[model samples]
Target: MPKMIFVNLPVRDLAASTTLYLALGGTLNPQFSGEQSSSIMFSDAIGVMLLTHAHYGVFTKRPIGDARRDSQVLLALSVDSRDAVDATLARAVAAGGRADPNPAQDHGFMFSRSVEDPDGYVWEIMWMDPAAIAGTPETA
Candidate 1:
């Protein structure tokens, strides 16, 4: 079976969120972008749902976590190379995201940089040398 991943993020303004995502090179899925939610297609099988807090509240009886002050989750996406990571992050910042206070880590085989989206959702974009990763038996 094919695999898919969905990441849902609560946003204060759906329209603004959608615009920022598009600016970051994310595509829109019309079937899910409407009065309630916007499905942003990042890749063939990866998508994010920008749901209003009230709409997202329906999914849980508990109150929504304050992503601006705190965080419900942090997401990380991988890229092809270190340059790709840098470029993607540049786009995000230009689109209104914040740079992580910490510096990037280059561990010979892997490189990672973190950034927070406009709503304060954290994302770590990393690039890895597949051969090095595979050779690192400890990772297994």
Candidate 2:
């Protein structure tokens, strides 16, 4: 089986966070969801577990950091094309996320933009030319 990643996040509003992730093209995985948490699957291998503050605390004794006020980690999602990156950012904004929390990055072979979720978690949407990734020049 392929390896998978499940990013666990503490959210203030479970419903709102779930909605935002769905808008960004994730599907709800009810098998792993409950009143205290929602499992959003971006792909078969990538998932996000949105947990309520109280539930999240069950796993850690440390205080929950206010994502809106402090930096923890920057999550990144790579899309198929530059247009897809823009589309994802647009969806995030429409779903109540703040767009471009950081400056947009554009290199000839890559492009990226960021969106801050309602809880202040930042997700970087990016696209990179396949040729660049493969260390080859693009032939036009």
Candidate 3:
């Protein structure tokens, strides 16, 4: 079986966070979700577990850091094309996220933009030329 990744995030408002994820093209997984938490599946192998701050504390005794002011981690998502990256950012903004929290990156081979969710968690949406990843040049 292939390994899957489920990133756990602490959210201040579960409903709002779930809505933002849905707007960003995630599907809700009811089986793994509840009043205190939500499972948003981005792909078969990628998922985000949005946990209420109280519920999140159950897993760790450390206090939750304010994502808006302090940076602990920057989550990144790879999309198929540059347009997809822009679309994802747009959706995030429409759902109450702040766009371009970080400077946008635009190397010839890769492009990226960032969005900060209502709770201040940052997600970088990016795209890269497959040829560049494969260490090959594009052909005419």
Q: Which candidate achieves the best lDDT against the true structure?
A: 2
Count of residue pairs whose backbone atoms collide, per candidate: 0, 0, 0
Which stretches in model 3 have alpha-carbon errors above 4 Å?
Answer: 137-140
lDDT score of residue 91 within candidate 3: 92
Cα lDDT tens digits, model 1, 40-106, are: 9889989999999889888877777777787667578888898988888888787777877347888
CA displacement after TM-score superposition, residue 94 of candidate 2 (Å): 0.7
Residues 1-140 of candidate 2 have per-residue lDDT tens digits of 99999999999999999989988889999999999999999999999999999999999999999889999998999899999999999998998889999999999799999999989999999999998888755553
122: Cα error in model 2, Å: 0.3
Alpha-carbon lDDT, every model? 0.82, 0.93, 0.93
TM-score of each: 0.85, 0.94, 0.94
Overall local distance difference test of candidate 1: 0.82
Which pairs of residues collide in candidate 3?
Answer: none
The order of the candidates by lDDT, greatest first, is: 2, 3, 1
Candidate 3, residues 1-140: lDDT per residue as tens digits? 88999999999999999999898889999999999999999999999999999999999999999988999897998889999999999998898888998999999899999999988889999999998888755543
